[model samples]
Target: MRTTATSRPTSVHLFCGAGGDSDGFRRAGFDVVLGANHWQKAVDTHAVNFPEAEHLCVDLDHYDMRKLPKARVLVGSPICTEGSPADGIKRPKAAPTPGQLSLLDEGPIADAAWERTRATAYDILRATEVHDFDAVVCENVPRFATAWPLFHWWLQGMAILGYRHQVVSVSAAHIGGENNPHAPQWRDRIFIVFTRQSMRQPDLAVRPPAWCPTCEQDIQAVQSWRNGRTIGKYRQQYDYRCPNGATCGHRIVEPYVRPAASAIDWTDTGIRIGDRPHHGRGPLAASTLRKIRLGLEKHRVPALVAVNHSDPGDGRAVPAHASPLATRTVRIGDGIALPAPFITEHRGGGSTTRAIADPLGAITAGGNHHGLVIPYRKGGPTTTAYPLHTIATRESAGLVLGSDALPEDIALEDCYFRMLSPREHLRGQRFTDDYTVLGNGGEQTMQAGNAVPSNVAQWIASALLEVL
Candidate 1:
């Protein structure tokens, strides 16, 4: 459990998905109230988990902040799919080429969604300021902070409200473990922390009681984060890794293990081992896969596309990168590297290509299959050589790769064979063992996906607590 500095607790939350953000503040000894989608299930989840506080299932846009409970800290994370750049915009990227027009520059649905989402965020920030929350924390995809215009307005609003603030993109890798090993993986998330300005810079920011950043092997590193943006030191990501090395490969993906419902890690209620995949798992169901893909396209997040590759092992098959039309090399991560990509958020959630590789004829775009492929490389069909890292030259190979692994593995509950359960994913998000997630039914898995990772909330809460 984290030590709380405040004599009294803080209270505030918005877009409070299953209480991931709220869990942190509460852990930091804050009295948190929640606001989020009016879905009965979500509201119930919040109420059940944090019964000591209020959980309002009202639209933040319609609710008046003045009428809401006032507390020292406020926090939130809006729906990311609607605003993420990962979703392809209806607008074309870059300047228009000849007769074509930029889709984002012209489309209706795209423009409406973008404007409404950002506007909503701006309204909430303004309202929070008016209500006098001492500190504010907003979480979102790293791109969300930069892609929208309204965020600039937030800075202005903070200036008007007499608060100093800063935004940093942090990742789950900071909380990684040997079983997790998601370092080297990059899934940039933006965390914005702000504190009310007091007496115009006369007060020195509270520095932690610590020893040194210049310490030796026998000592632990001491550090601090400030809302005033004193990023005089290296960023967190840099601090987490070996500066001389290449990417660590593992990154933050969807949480796969559920945290304990209590602070103890070894209780009977602690995470039970379940199915998680290694390599060789195939795509999830079609509908579920589509949601992630469509979500990415709509949000403008980039997708991998196979351009040219060589398959030295296989004789001649490959499939298209999830990318539409044709593009350069498709993007994929080795399982040993980054945090695994998120499983579909909702059940039966769809595929967005986990691994894309090319080999001799295996990785060609000729087939409808996804994942690794062996493509026909040099020479002709009889004499060609394929590379393991890619598959391209020709699109068609005689057979598909190990897609059967998915069903068989998901069917079982063994090591590296099982599909990631909702519980595991929640754990990945960093939820502590305690935050309760109430699902609609008795199915714990559903509840896990629906809720936010408690650890992420902990990070935010810890930062907010530091504002004292």
Candidate 2:
């Protein structure tokens, strides 16, 4: 029953899981005409969220692109797990540390899967030829660009198709809390926007301004940073050592620092300054802070260097600051450490004298068996303690332990670990409370994790609008 916005540019979303990206496009004033995906549950959820759009629950490889409606913009998020660092082919050459290694070799299977996945991107490009779309936006993990022949082939194909492209890496958390409070989860992703040769190449370097808590201002935060000499800038052996080796605090290396690509220095000084939260803001609630830390580690983002904490009840102790365990140190003389009195631990380990406190000081997904322990604080709501934010997977849901339960909340004790209800997953993904997530817990979880953050999608789409 929805009427088409004839005046607006139309967009076709392929691999449109849960329609978060499409939601952004709609917010950006694009008429989202079609959303196609392989998963019926995802398509069902998309239909529920975007009931007006034409929903095709067919696999992209089989879908007929020529039959699709003509549109000016095309956006796709190809499967990332196959091309991600999480994939086996991209596994680090170094052996994993104890308790770190994943036993399965996802590479060969993933590579085979990627062969099919990469086809979706190429298929979109081919459709571009027939449809003559004005622009295309593709997203995936930054590691996607590192996939062997696939990356090279993709660029070649783009060149042949007459599109100019640029890739920008961004994080949902650093996108700024004030404007995007809905998507505080820390997720790093890359966006590649390409314009047809006939169209004016847009300056796709545009990024959302980030709020600096310390400065109390919105700043054009640098999106990426590079430090140290550029690779392949080979100099003679004698030229490698620093001229001021004795006085210079930095290590002696080849004498070239790439022009600071960003206003924010990648140097340790910049990291320290950039990482500080806003002034006068109360420390993130202890339970919330613990989840953030665990999430950051999971995402491989740098851990927060300092936290406002209290001593643990058990004898286990930890360093007051995020130093000592530091492999590389940046001496930023900003001595502002705010106080949030909550239990603390160094590296989630207990002190030698005392066993690690119950509901360990550092929060993690823990293991499959126990799930995460909701920590006890003096006055906060006890019901929702730990694993505070629901992740995309059922395995990522919060679990409770009987020992960690209080006398009053004995009812929840038997429930022990519990998966986040569908509504919670939707909220974590920044979806509105009314948004419907189809299917059982497992399928819904996959859809949630795979969907792009609507805020990020809107941010990118809005920026693309200026260029388009």
Q: Number of the top candidate by lDDT? A: 2
> Tens-digit lDDT track for model 2 on 264-382?
11121111111224332232234333432442222121212211111111111223344311100111211111111111222223221111111111111111111121222343323
Model 1 is weakest, by summed lDDT over 10 consecutive residues, at 359-368
What lDDT is obtained when candidate 1 is compared to the true structure?
0.39
Q: Which stretches of candidate 2 lie over 4 Å from their true place?
A: 1-6, 83-119, 176-182, 206-218, 227-372, 377-419
Instruction: Supply every candidate's count of residue pairs whose N, Cα or C atoms clash at under 3 angstroms.
Output: 85, 5
Give lDDT: candidate 2, residue 135. 80
**On residues 126-182, what C-alpha lDDT tens digit does candidate 1 reach at each position?**
666677766777666654555555667767877788778766645433323233222
* lDDT score at residue 49, model 2, on the 0-100 scale: 78
> Residue 304 of candidate 1: its Cα lDDT?
25
Quantify all predictions' global Cα lDDT against the true fold. 0.39, 0.45
Tell me the spans in candidate 1 whose CA falls farther than 4 Å from its real position.
Answer: 1-6, 83-119, 176-187, 199-417, 432-434, 440-452
